[model samples]
Target: MRHEELFYLLALQKVEGVGDIVAKKLISHCGTAENVFQTKAAQLKMIDGIGSMVLRNLKDKLVFEKAEAELRFIEKNNINWTYFGDEKYPERLKHCIDGPVLLFASGNINLNKKRIISIVGTRQITSHGTEFCKNLIAELAPLDPIIVSGFAYGVDIVAHQAALEHNLQTIGIVAHGLNQIYPKIHKRYVSKIEENGGFMTEFWSSSNPEKENFVKRNRIVAGISEATIVIESADKGGSLITANMANDYNRDVFAVPGRITDKFSQGCNNLIKTQKANLLTSAADVVYILNWNFETKAKPIQKQLFISLNNNEQKIYDYLQKTGKQLLDIIALECDFPIYKISSTLLDMELKGVIRPLPGKLFEAI
Candidate 1:
């Protein structure tokens, strides 16, 4: 939240060759961006991912002007910005390694809620896909989970609008930053989302939507939810990418099986056949897997786990909430704590009824 910290984050994001892994290494070793700015080449070289290219870029400092410009633009547009550690950052998105370091928001959707599901599928959807998305989302409406989707044509748009029609909070994760809405036609719904919930993105306002950005963005959609549903996708559709990312994150991935011969159904069928996804005939399948009604059966202590946390504990707790499932290694890397320290701290926190450990050495906030 400090100006200097913002400067470092912006600078790090703008660095030409510094990806998430590299940024993690640099942030871990340097302590903070302010520290990184004062770091020497020899010290920066000690971090594994930083190479001569990164060293040169950091030394030259290309991110300052760009960051400042973005700040100014955000101010002008009256958009909300949330950094990773901010209280307002989406709880389900905070823990993923590829989670956006920063977010530009313009919607009414609450990213942190008891239930959120991302609905994704091919841009070219079929009549069946449209009906499937609409009816499924309508069924989900009574449960009131936050519905997320990229506002592309076909199923994506249908999913968001369906949630809106049902008076549920829905978020559209844009491929580009807040500079402009792709397809332009959905501009009408932008204010609708903001008035009801909101949209979010990782890229700076000025950065144009690139092909690769969509891939990077999908992880956010996948990472921030209890589950991901593929309404309809061809074998190569972007929705499949989000579903796969959900699997890697250990979140539920569901597919609505369609006619075996339909091209749009091929990806969903393959996912179900290969066991990459669970076959979901209806919204009830997802609610069952997530144990949505389990809270009603939970003891008082379990309910307390979600609400009662001291400030420091809440930072770690909220991080796990936004990001979902993460191994101690990744959590340590992102939180900038040594693995042993994080493990010990998490153990203590777990014993205190603040978090839950999942299989595969991952942790989640209650």
Candidate 2:
């Protein structure tokens, strides 16, 4: 976007009572942020939700000064930004009514045609949660999905580290501005993370890591990804907030099931019990639920002949070959395997290039 337009948009954000939804409405009606200011009061009053307070606030000239200062900060620091209408903005987030009109980013972040998943959990991560989180990323490494997290301690940092270990792009959706790191100790990971993925936020350079900012930040972590996973959380926490946001966005939510007596597992258990999230056991659950196709790059058709399949995989491959395409449940029943076993087996087959997954949980021999 042009500097002139961005300046207007930033000023529009400073207008009290005008938020992402209202700004979007104004922009959509006026065609551009600059045009919004140029539009007549009578014309603006015709907009559905435009009220007296919002109209009055738009006249505040101080917003311009603030916008100018922030713009200078952006230029001086070489900060990267994306407007809501820009093609480079997160495609999934664009559909969200509350998504930020402008997103500031740093590092080599790219979301084009990428499989993005957000992993969020309690700051007090348990040993089991850490192992589960790390193993999950490692198992999903071959699919090369981008990992999204809050960049906080516990599960957030664990997910980022796991993604980095596998050399996959990992994005840190921060609660504060990009001008400073929140925990201070995490400054060490900044360079390494920027090398692969990077940090993203809607806050300005002048903003601080306030308490309320995290709830707002949760929306981005939820909205930007196709799915959100909770490795561990208490009955109430920020991770649950993120899960609810993901559910509200109509995206898939998954939680690792744990013992009933464990405090950290209560939230995940409750989510599963209430059917708010799918019961996540292994990477195969994600692969099956998201219907991810592992065979993106081209490989010779004859390559499957050279690959070896175990007894269960061979059975499914033979069945799929004979039956053409079949539902996951049907395959499980026909192959005399449980649903959990069938899901893992199908994912394994997909990774081995012997079978391909289709839409709606259907699979066929390659």
Q: Can you give the TM-score per candidate against the true fold?
A: 0.77, 0.89
In the range 1-366, model 2's lDDT, one tens digit per residue, is: 589988998999899999999999999999999888889889999999999889999899999999999999888999999989999999999999999999999999989756999999999999999999999998788788999999998999999999999998999999888899978999999999999999999999888989899999999999999999999999999999999999999999999999999999999999999999999998888987897879534353474473477788888888988999999999999999988677778887776677887888888887
Report the backbone clash tally of model 1: 17
After superposition, the stretches of candidate 1 with alpha carbons farther than 4 Å from their true spots are: 294-366
The residue-by-residue lDDT of candidate 1 on 1-366, one tens digit each, is 565566678777887887765676677687776677689999888877678988888766447888788767777888777766678887877677767777778856565567888999988888888888898876566567888888888888999889889887888888898878887988888877778777888878766778988888899889878899998988777898899999998889999898888899999999999999999876657755675542222233455455565655677877888999888798888877776557546754654455677777788876
Off by over 4 Å in 2: 296-340, 352-366
lDDT of all predictions: 0.78, 0.92
lDDT of candidate 1 at residue 109, scale 0 to 100: 53
Model number with the top TM-score: 2
**Among these predicted structures, which one has the highest lDDT?**
2
lDDT of 2 at 300: 38
